[model samples]
Target chain A: MEKMLAEKPVNVNEEGYLLEFAQWDKDIANAIAVEEKVELRDDHWKAIEWIQSEFKKDSPLSIRGIKNSGALNIKEFYELFPGGPLKKASKIAGIPKPKSCI
Target chain B: MKNLIILGAGTSGTMMANHLVSKLPKQEWNITIVDQYKTHYYQPGFLFLPFDIYKEQDVKKEGKKFIPKGVNYIQKKIEKILPKENKVQLENETIPYDLLIVATGSKIAPQETEGMNGPNWHKNIFDFYTYEGSLALRNKLRDWKGGKLVIHITEMPIKCPVAPLEFAFLADTYFRKKGMRDKVDITYVTPLSGAFTKPKATAALHYLLEEKGIKEVIDFNIDRVDYENNKIIDYADTEVEYDLLVTTPTNMGDDLIKRSEMGDQLNFIPTNKATLQSLENENIFVIGDASNIPASKAGSVAHFEAEILTENIQNYIKGKELKEEFDGHANCFIETGNGKALLIDFNYEQEPVQGSFPFAAIGPLSLLKESKLNHMGKLAFRWIYWNMLIKGIPIPFVTAKMTKKGKQITI
Candidate 1:
């Protein structure tokens, strides 16, 4: 669905992840971050940047991937984003949430 | 005759051997399959094994019984695969291959988590992903005065993803049958956001958790097992205490992938998801849980992949363009206790929705809804698995690629 983010129409899914990465921008991210109750700081952006880069490469994101990325340890990752870090950070970075075949 | 070697005589490797043995011209290709073990385990039976729903004899048979007469079967440890050399290193012999199929599947690595395989291993802490683990759990449950029964998943990409949930369901049934339903506190814990990976499934099946009184602990990225305290501590410092901990530990591709330096961080080989051809080399193909495909690591997925892979291998041999036809198709029966189960039919593009299967509005087997017929199908599957599935026989009405005929995708 198209919704106004940073005063611009951005397409997102029901869960608020961006449908197209092209529609993602810094202002839009900050807007979504506000909705997710996450304040975008340097530490948060580091993880978000790493996540978006991985998504662009079509690499499936997982907690395991984050642990191995060398950008941050898992403990600091949880602290940076709080609660469900991977899903929250991916939303802030405008990538699809990680999923497994059920 | 050129040699076509298959590593691992498990489901995928054995099916490949059966598939190509008749298709590959006898005068042109010699097929040989290798595995260190003699037993071909009915892996799905591991779920029922703990509840004593299945016996050891029912789940295992001689691996040789399944391999066709023409193919050579070697029971020996595989040392490594020298992929660049197009050769495989066995314990004492190095065999060159015109084509190599890697089916060395995934297994549980309890040691991947600290304190998982520590002092209390197999005593109270258990895994049912293996025959040993299942049998050990069976013995443990035989006399187990139930406490907090924690059914956990240490990480994702584990084989038979639904088995853990089924374990929770069956545990409820088992305890009820034993007249000790209240004696056990069943908790389903996962690293995923909910009881299921897909949103629709989570929505469709959330009632099972509520109906059976199974507590859920989601988004739990476990850091270590506090074995001394009988607690699993996550990165967030959240702890879930358990008396009887049934955990599926970190599942990884075989260490041979690591030794050969041919796999990703999880040791799964990178492969073309559609063609089943290894991305790194054209002559190499991977199937089953060994490849890092975004599909459930289950026998059903392997069965579907075997059909597409057989065609692809023949295409590669015939110098034809490979068909990008594998659509990440996976069909599985989710046992939801009380002589009922749910059947889910899905592919890369389709989420399992409410409908009939293999026929539109005429399903003897309903999709995404719990039914007793589906439960019967689950029981009858053991026979099909042993008699037909591993023999490369096409299951009636099931296709290599999923069909959208009977599905209600509008939801």
Candidate 2:
């Protein structure tokens, strides 16, 4: 495997999900989203913002939680991140991977 | 007392044993469940093994543990089923039955595809249907540095139809996390015209595939697997090359069904789709993947069919009309990776629609929509399968019949 060196190194799990929530920032989140091939729109930013806040509060992050948070509806949430909405949204939001994501 | 023999001590067979043990009169009938193996595998857990979401021990349990107290559990390979004589031929002896339940579920036949079982069988070509196959694939993925990964389904009627789609989605997430998403060229190949069997779900899934940057090759009937060339050839002579192939090979009923000459061309016993009764034999009933029904060949279908079949079996014993009719009620949680999943509930007449499930307006779970709750539901199902389902304990609110109460019909 080729060495993955970043200017601002981030600790991630074997599957690449974020391990430490405190280490996340806008630059790292943007980089992750770019790798996921998702162009972050305004709504995407809202999802990321909500997820990060929820993580800070130690609240459960879910599709329903996102929808209930008024950040995105079910269709809009799926449209914003496509496949694996919670996983991708969490990654881009710079939060630890959800327990159910495995 | 008369013998009521059940073939295959798998999911359906075990469930039937638990159900009939309490319902049937022990004085008039003796319940017996037969199989060749002693381990009962939670088959759905196989889908998560390749991704390391589930471990080997999580999906396996002692088969005898689930067999009810009053029922006789026999561990023997069935040689053949003599339906005419109302007897089953085992390796050493023959056992006669007044009533028989065929629950010998389907098996993946990799050899049916040319070159599939060749030198690259477990090396580059792997199937996640079996326990060993899933483990091998997991080991292979650990060192795989991302190349052309193709997930293909050879034919339809495979157990858990949405599993391949789940694999594709999970692989995308897996590679992305491995920091090699750009290096891997992921593709999903299927015999169907769309990503799934149903129409509405197909459209939604197609969009998800495009969003994930995973190429989808549909309606491509695979004719052969070119192992040396590392390519899969379709009947139309189209070639799809792959560095690694995760395939769901042609799934067929047990070999005993074929030897007995009581099954269709695919070794599935022909049965009344509504009644679950064998078409050629009155005393025989086929459940799970062993039946040639229009419904999806899935565990949920079998779970629903068992409820109806149990009632019908009781009715048969009492010389009463078999009034229970199964409407092919099936529900599945489609795992879309990254900790989110979608729930779908439908029957023979209605396709999956976007709506709340079990209730019309108040749904803790959404239908046809991906959610974290659905993912939790999928994960929690493992516990339910082991405890409630096989024990014949009725799940509250979720009945065998499909209801339109919470479903919105969409054209």
Query: Which interface RMSD values do the candidates have, in the order shown?
Result: 1.9, 17.6
Q: Across residues B1-411, which tens digit of lDDT does each residue of candidate 2 receive?
A: 899999999889999998899898889999989999989999999988888888889999999999989888889899999988999999999999999999999999998888998999989999999999999999999889878999998875677878888999999888888899999999999765457545467655557788789898865667789998999987556799999999999888999999999876567888888889988998999999998886778889999999999999988888988854899899889888789999999887677888897678888889998899999999999999999998889887898999998887743
- For residues B210-265, what per-residue lDDT tens digits would candidate 1 score against the true structure? 99999999888899999999999888888999999999999999999999999988
Query: How many Å off is the CA of B256 in candidate 2?
Result: 0.4
- Regions of candidate 2 where Cα sits further than 4 Å from its true position: A1-102
Q: Please report, as a residue range, the 10-residue window in candidate 2 chain B with the lowest summed lDDT.
A: B191-200
Candidate maximizing DockQ:
1
Error of 1 at B170 (Å): 0.5
Per-candidate DockQ values are 0.55, 0.01
lDDT of 2 by residue, A78-100 (tens): 67876556667887887654431
Going through the candidates in order, the fraction of native interface contacts each one reproduces equals 0.41, 0.00
- Candidate 2: pairs in clash: A101-B339
Q: What is the fnat of candidate 2?
A: 0.00
